[model samples]
Target: MPQESSHRVVLMVDENSNPFEMSCAIEVFGLPRPELGRDLYDFRLCAAEPRTRMRDGFFTLSDVADLGAAEEADTLIVPNRPDTDAPRAPHVLDAVRRAHARGARLVGFCSGAFTLAEAGLLHGRPAACHWMWADSFRARFPGVRLDQDVLFVDDGDILTASGSASALDLSLHVVRRDHGAEIANHVSRRLVFAAHRDGGQRQFVERPVPHIRDESLAPVLTWAQERLGEPLTVADLAARARVSQATLHRRFRAQLGTTPLAWLTGERVNLARRFIERGEKRLDVVAARSGLGTAANLRARLRQETGLSPSAYRRRFGPSGGEPVTP
Candidate 1:
């Protein structure tokens, strides 16, 4: 990993690149955040050519740097590359492979997962790709384990998103990872975007009907989120949903690609994370509010979810002024 003082991110673009995905990366990592008092990332856009028209012929980008520019990047992002089945340009594939060999984080947005797959970076790894291309991707790269359900997959160094919008989710996630939730939330708020989304969320739900009004789980979800401070069981969730426990389980699996308990635990962890970031020094207070029951349970759960202890997490991401935030 590059030193935090000078973290660099390079956007790898090509003739077939989707302009939307390229712009998404720029919005998250390229633009200067004056509110933060310093540039969060050194962002650059690179292509194999000096200048090239995007996938759509009407727009063109000028003075583009070469793929070699990505050699020193802390993170190398490949935006949506149009064709999933076609072989990637040899030079493009080589540059990605070389960068990965040197420990640079690689991000594949949407069909750009194909580029990483073509370069053999995703072999034997769980990856996410646009749902429409999942079958073709599996057929083309049988070595890759593609999960179409999730919005994105962050496997330490190699990150991949399911589709166009998930690119934003992944980008925000990278910001949250490198800096902290505070900075990430700042960027999200500035863009009027949702601050953070768990990568495990479904890219699209397969509802039986067109409208979600009557069958909507919104009310139950709201209830659950509000009561995250209390111990919640699957039975409790079922009662709140006004459905059988089995039905609730089925709905969660079909719609969320996860169990109800898993979702609840994740929410509790999220609550704890926010509490810690806001400078809640008392572990038991944080734990109780987050519904983890006690400090011991909070420590184990936080470590499992975030790989950090309560104290360590607070120290790393706590509020700058040391003034505790009011609930």
Candidate 2:
């Protein structure tokens, strides 16, 4: 069991702020993980005012820490209110600015981007917001590169999630980046959520009107997972689903916002990474078992995906790894 973390995460709750996003942040960062034998973050929630009404006046919050709590944060989840156009509290924006200037990592969930934009922290940077607010966000803050379709954007010091639920996605991604795939997976499993969905994947994919019965990929995905050690191909997956390769490809794109081959490659990469983190020393063995075929391919893929070679990854995440080096 590791010691409790020193990393502080401060969430800003303001008038009319959405509670759903707040719960998402708390679920991910606030809850202590007894399973891991320690808490992953030193989490706190702060409000600029002594009393505040939440979104649609669903509830009132009080007795939280003062806005000054953000000053001590290593990561600051910014204030988000329902009225995207309404100006944030001047003091709240100032606090955000201070946190940014101090180099604290900032996160904006949904309309929270408006707060960061108001604070001048997102200028000339990529951000993601709910699709409903995309047009307004772009028109008002053209300088901030708003990726209207992505689920989230991880821009090093600043991050943004497109919608309320996607806040969990961004939080899990942060865990993966800060800890590693293994810890992130454990957290996701605890939440009963998918471990990963690439930030670049479309958050809102439009579907054509259905002309035929819709089929699910769950069975086929499970089938493929059990056979990842075998040399798998799109054709093999298509055969398992009893569908044509074109249909398989179409379903993968429409449902997953990715090609079949891309999904398969990602799974293999994750498998290789898991093996290394479990203390596999021989890169060639890890590659073969993960179906990547060779150490050279493992090296190229691991570095491309994780920015770390097999040995470096193991040294940082394997059994003997006392603490993971910050990425």
Candidate 3:
């Protein structure tokens, strides 16, 4: 039997829902765990209607709770909805808004972000949704800060995940926040997944997606990543790739769909983030080592990208001591 608690989590499911996402939620919160020696979560599966049919033609009956349940839940989870481009139900949108208004944490996994955006809960908040639907999501919610380069975005009370595997990362992050690293690590071990994955959705973007291969920029990118701390320019990159700067730019635009400077900045930022996470606190040192030149430059760049100050980010992810030595 599950322990009764005032704090509850309501997972909203609907017809044609992706069973894998639903199962991800259940695997994280619904399963019984006596080893933890306490109630982990009060998880409930509720739907808009009483009977919901999955994608594979299986029907599962739900004790369907009304919109009122959203008002009472401490956390509201919107799992992957139908893959179609259809908008979320009006009632479901209202429920999500009401729950958010009542201080409940709202979570969206994969296409579930569409529902949150429709509810107006993601306005001005940084959100991560499936890369494939990023364009549509941005078009629909113009005010929301849609970041396609992260696995998950934990923006205070609201959380959004990129896609399927990212759901696990977000859930593990939640467990870490609520129960600390020890418990979160245990849960991760039980699931046979990494306790934490390095990098973000930037690492998962479809590289070489199109069959038309351009071997031109590939070696240049590999070389650039290897020497992130070294000062690099378009001329240098072009020279290394044995191509004109114009040709290099065209190849980057055609293959990576971004400018050379933008890609280099992204790589530098990624490196700085890794250093910060490893307890490196001296902003000046981090900036120089990551090729951003100065502490002020790093601060401006990091703030523009992640909305976090160097000190704040270091405090959150860096080592226990104040500043880490330059490595």
Candidate 4:
């Protein structure tokens, strides 16, 4: 077990902020948990300005702290903001920059990446944001490498999640980083969520839809998910969907914004990540289970997507074992 910290976490909330995203940070950091023998992070929700109104028809008239709260925090969380296009308030951006300069970690959830970008903190940094607003984000912050596909991106001190639910993933990642996999997994089991989600995964997944108007792809996706351990190819998927290879490729690209092969590789990598996080140290087992066919194939694909080899990936995300592998 690691030594407890006296540092607090300040969550900055603005008017019209998504309550769910705010709640995600609160759930992960605000709640108390003594059973895990871990020191709970003291969480504070502060208004960017004052008298903020939430989107859920509730007014935040009280419990508002000033920018001084951010200065004292060990970690600062910015959940999904109401407006991604608008410039971040100068005061808020200054607080963020000050926190980082003082060695505090800054986290952004979904569209909250815009706040960091506006502060110029994400300049030349690889950040992840919701895929829906990727184009707009790129247009706003030309210097930031906005990766739309990944569920999250961790650039050392600054972390960003791609979508709403990915906020939970990134929070768990922070926990894992500060503590270890055991504590992270314990919290995950308590929350009934996976301990870790690969940051390299695509935001919107590919699946066969019944028609152009058909939005439901759950059944086919579930079916494919069940057979991830098997040798599944695009041709096989197309056959399963009772469509031509060309049609499958076209539909996948239109809906998921990626090729069928790319989608399949992502799914396989996602599976491998789960295994790695679960303390599966053997490369062969991870490769076999993720259907990468061979360990060499897994290493090549994992490095291509994540810029980390299997051993390095496992060490970074795997349970408490040996020392982390050098890149």
Candidate 5:
């Protein structure tokens, strides 16, 4: 049982709904936080039918609330139905539209994007779904700005994660948004999960066993992390990997789906954010230590990635000598 919470999260399940994503929602939103001495949200499950067959009829989920309950949700999670081509239940779609009209936040995990898209909520909106369905989703709804590469897309009121596992990432993100980083860290720790995984991280990739052995980027990544403040460039990374710049680029693309420079900058920005959260006061020192070079660059990167200025972020996420985000 969860503690009483003002925020109500309702999950809508229909035929062929993926059980994994349903569990993801329940884990993130349904559980009690005895450690925190309170609960996070009031969670409920609703279905258009009293008994719904889920995901190839592997299980029958019964005794959940009816679709009308969705109208009461502060946040409504739509079904991640694996059968993407199947038409959505008309009542379910209407419930979703009503929820949206009432300004409820909408969430889609994996193929759940199809439900939202079917409701016509995702038109001209940035959304994400399973990468395998990218081509079909596009053919069905070209108006949607579908970003298949990212783990998730946070388009303000509508949030969508691209795969089953990315559902956890998006849920943790919602926790951070509603509460703060410290509280979110505590929740992640309770679940034994990583506290922060960027929404922009790639989720679509198939790494086959290479016919021939290839060098792993682990060694060079570790090397660059140790020297982030030393003005390292693509050239430096290539030299450290004992490969040419072009070869390094190819490897990074194949392995990480991002260029080396972008990854390095992201690392630096993360470092800077940590320093700020840990009570760093001098902007110049923070910038220099994080290898952002100057306060201007630091400001740009932080704003671009986090949508928050350093001072603003610190005020919200910085320690008050309370619970440190670190374990």
Candidate 6:
């Protein structure tokens, strides 16, 4: 596990802050997990003022910490701010910059990306935001490389989630990074959410409306997911979907926001992660089962995607085979 600390994660709030996203952060970082036998983080809710009214003025946040809390945080999380185009308070921007300058990890959810970009932290760095705000974000901060496809973008100390639900993904990802996949999965189980989700927000954005029936690509995706152990290619997927390869490529880009090969690689990596977590010690077996062809290939792919070797990943997140040590 990474070094544990009584690290403070200050959730910076404002009049435009979304309560739901803040609650998500609190749920992930605030609540104590006895299963781990130690507090993972010290969570604080901070605002421009001690007591601030939330978005829509329907609810008021009372007894919140002041912006000074952000300056002292180890991680500063900015939840969904209501308007991306509106000016942020000078104090808030200053607090965020101070936190970042002091080496605190900066996180933004939804419109909060605008705050990070506005503070100049996202210049030339990859960022993610809700697809609906893509145009506005580009117009406001053209220097920031905005990837509207992924659920979240983790550019080292700077992280951004695409939307409200994706905020949970980002928080869990932080936990996974700091603690391990095991603890993050435990938190996920407690919250009744998948530790990791398939695909990205692009799939949702493409068809925002609920599909009462399966879309054209749904069956093919399901089929591919089930057959990851097999050697699956674009031709195989296209044949399964009964569409031309070119049409299948169009469908994947439209619905999944990635190429077929990229999606396949992601799925294989996910399966490999699961295998490693379950104590699959043989890298060769893991590679063959995940259809990555060989152990060397698996090593390269896992390193590229997760920056961890197979054995290192297993050591961090694999079955403990015993009790967890309390920090």
Tens-digit lDDT track for model 1 on 1-327? 332348899998887678889989999999886556568899989988877778867587778788878898989997466766667788989999999999999999999899998888899999999999988989988999999989999999999999998899999999888766667777888778867678888888666464745656667877998999987898999998889999988888766667888888877887888888887789899899999989999999989877888887877788876344333
Q: What TM-score would you give candidate 5 relative to the actual structure?
A: 0.84
RMSD of candidates 1 onward, in order: 3.6, 3.0, 7.5, 5.7, 3.2, 4.3
Of 3 and 5, the candidate ahead on TM-score is 5
Candidate 3 lDDT tens digits, 1-327: 434444587888877788777888888877666664455678888877777777666667566775666677888997466564877778878888888887999888888888888887888888988888888888888999998877788887999888888888888877655543445566777898866542243526334445685555668888998898989887889899888888777777665556788888877886787677666778888998899999999999888766678887666655664333232
lDDT, candidate 5, 101-155, per-residue tens: 9999999999989999999999999998988999999999999999998989999
Q: What is the per-residue lDDT of model 4 for residues 107-177, given as tens digits with 9 covering 90 to 100?
A: 99998899888888999999999888989999888999989988899999999998888999899888866
TM-score, candidate 1, is 0.85
- Where does the lowest 10-residue lDDT sum fall in candidate 3? 197-206
Which has the greatest lDDT?
2
Error of 2 at 90 (Å): 1.4
Better TM-score candidate (2, 4): 2
* Residue range with the least summed lDDT across 10 consecutive positions in model 5: 205-214
lDDT scores in order: 0.84, 0.88, 0.75, 0.78, 0.88, 0.83
- Alpha-carbon runs more than 4 Å astray in model 3: 1-6, 56-58, 198-327
**Global CA lDDT of candidate 2, please?**
0.88
Highest-TM-score candidate: 2
TM-score of each: 0.85, 0.94, 0.62, 0.69, 0.84, 0.79
Clashes of each: 0, 0, 0, 0, 0, 0
lDDT per residue, candidate 2, 1-327, as tens digits? 546899999999999999999999999999988667668999999998999899998899999999989999999999887799899989999999999998999999989999999889889999999999999999999999999888999999999999887899999999888877878888888899988888878887657456766577889999998888899999999999999999998888888888899888888888888777767788889999998988999899989888887888887777664433221
Clashing pairs in 4: none
Off by over 4 Å in 6: 1-5, 35-40, 148-150, 182-186, 189-204, 208-213, 216-227, 230-254, 315-327
Badly placed stretches (over 4 Å) of model 2 are 206-214, 321-327
